[model samples]
Target: MSLEAPVVRGVELADDRTPRPVTASETVYEGLIWDVRRDTVDLGSGTVRRDFVEHTGAVAIVAVRDTPGVEGASQVALIRQYRHPIGATEWEIPAGLLDKEGEPPLAAAQRELAEEVDLTARTWNVLADFHPSPGAMSEAIRVYLARDLAEVAEADRHTREAEEAEMTAAWVDLDEAFAAVLAGRIGNATAVIGILAARGAKEAGWVTLRDPDAPWPAHPAHR
Candidate 1:
């Protein structure tokens, strides 16, 4: 007996802001993290100018464990840190920018895990990839699933400074974290996506997990 391929209907997505002919472009400001650029784009309807932030992209780690290898709810590592831009302390997962030249997203996530939480993981999976704000900025963030964790020694751990210096961390159950995301208690975008994605992946027996160093086409750094 022969089986035919199932027909999958493609959704008709409309994107009015497709990349148009750039008549003019220039950098407006350069900051420690990102750069602001002004561009004149022709939308076919008319020409409009706007300023946007050009980012290098970043990564977030959902450090989780489930009795090492057993199948069950896992514990997630979370952090509370001061975000000066928002003027409020927020709960989030360990994350950092892909700042280093030629550094991969997974490497950045691993570095953030060690730097922020003084922890390392033996198993890593790609959880979710998203654009924090595509309309205003070119910032794409990839969140990873990290397991088989181990704490760094006091002597080998990085000396936290700046925003990380005041950060506090805790381990929360996966289901509870998901509840927090649903309750609007977790405001961080990466954290919220990571928690919900992790739950879904867990329910699917984690068979849909991608490689840790999976190719991220949306990440400008990769481009």
Candidate 2:
């Protein structure tokens, strides 16, 4: 199972422009996002065969509404979208992949929350970074907890439906969201991870999410 190339860092070589041979029949089969390509790498005394994969970056975020519930539960905002890839309606926190040219993670998160959920967050804190599917996809999801949210003036209507496939905004509690995740209602990994992270951040008080100027416990806290 050990298929790593036995090459060292900064291998001594005279001709840097010299190209190595790529064996055509080294790998078994190829897979999307990555190929099972094998090649015999050159070493001092021997050549070893190996295979590896490449990746591109991605990002995700949990845009928490942070509203108090009627039943003493904490509420978190979410979105319902029809994911054509999975062919099932999915509920997830606001998230998207990084720009092809590579943009900042938090900036992308903020953009996504605004574009998808119609809310822009003022305070943002990075929660975690994870490789949602490292085996094949070049997807690296950056999770963030956005707070101090205010609704945007409007959203891009064109991408809201079919292109994005987002139906409507849905808000649920942390416990309920987690329960849905457990019961297979929340199927997106980004939302699950981001919600769990947001829950932790909320507990730690790093996210004073509600409007600071508003009267606490009666405005959005007690409602």
Candidate 3:
């Protein structure tokens, strides 16, 4: 059987979900946070088996504030934490998994910001959304741009433990963060995407941003 190429109609680029017939599926591994699954699928051409991680999705925040005395400049909040997989300390924005059942993405971002950095924001916008590695993982992340910042009250702060207890927070100029991303200093997927997307949004006068509670169809937990 010959497979015909799909027709293209417009210049606007977008991603669509393509569902294939899963002939067989099974949970290969179940961990504390995520699970691995192996599946046999029919891709029109033939049947193939693959293993992938099943994720609960997550949310990230690019908390921003205008630079004092620096016209048209902004600063972003960053956190440095030790990532065991990479065996190195990496810089990243405030983020957390969508493990809580029925909680919205905006609320998760808000909670992460306060928990990770002890900060809160009055304004929020959907900066960007993406799947870091679709081939091997079903993780989708939404990065939010948060402004009008204020510190969370000490009494209401979440207690940090494990790796989080050793995490450090800092405020860096957005431009500097962008430069760091370019220079290979900041390697976290969420941080790189958020910094670059935030810079682009800022250059466009933030007219491209969406509402904080905008529809996120890509996240399985939300959808």
Best-matching candidate per lDDT: 3
The CA lDDT at 116 in model 3 is 98
Model 1: residues >4 Å from true position, as ranges? 1-18, 67-71
Candidate 3 residues 1-223, lDDT tens each? 3368676687788777667999999999999888999999999999999999999999999999999999999999999999999999999999999989888899999999999999999999999999999999999999999999999888999999999999999999999999999999999999999999999999999999999988888985575
Model 2: what TM-score?
A: 0.64
TM-score of each: 0.87, 0.64, 0.94
Model 2 agreement with the true structure over 2-72: per-residue lDDT tens digits: 67857657866432334356434355566674456555666646676665443445556676665563543
Number of backbone collisions per candidate: 0, 0, 0
Q: What residue runs in model 3 are displaced by over 4 Å at the alpha carbon? A: 1-10
Where does model 2 exceed 4 Å of error?
A: 1-55, 68-73, 100-102, 155-161, 207-223
Best by TM-score: 3
Summarize candidate 1's per-residue lDDT along 16-119 as a digit string, tens digits: 43467999999999998789999999889999999999988889999997644646658899999999888989999999988898777777888999999999
Extract clashing residue pairs from model 3.
none
Give the Å shift of residue 56 in candidate 3. 0.4
Better of 1 and 3 by TM-score: 3
Q: Report the CA-based lDDT of candidate 3 relative to the real structure.
A: 0.94
Per-residue lDDT, model 1, residue 124, is 94
Per-model lDDT: 0.88, 0.63, 0.94
In model 2, which residue pairs have backbone atoms overlapping below 3 Å? none
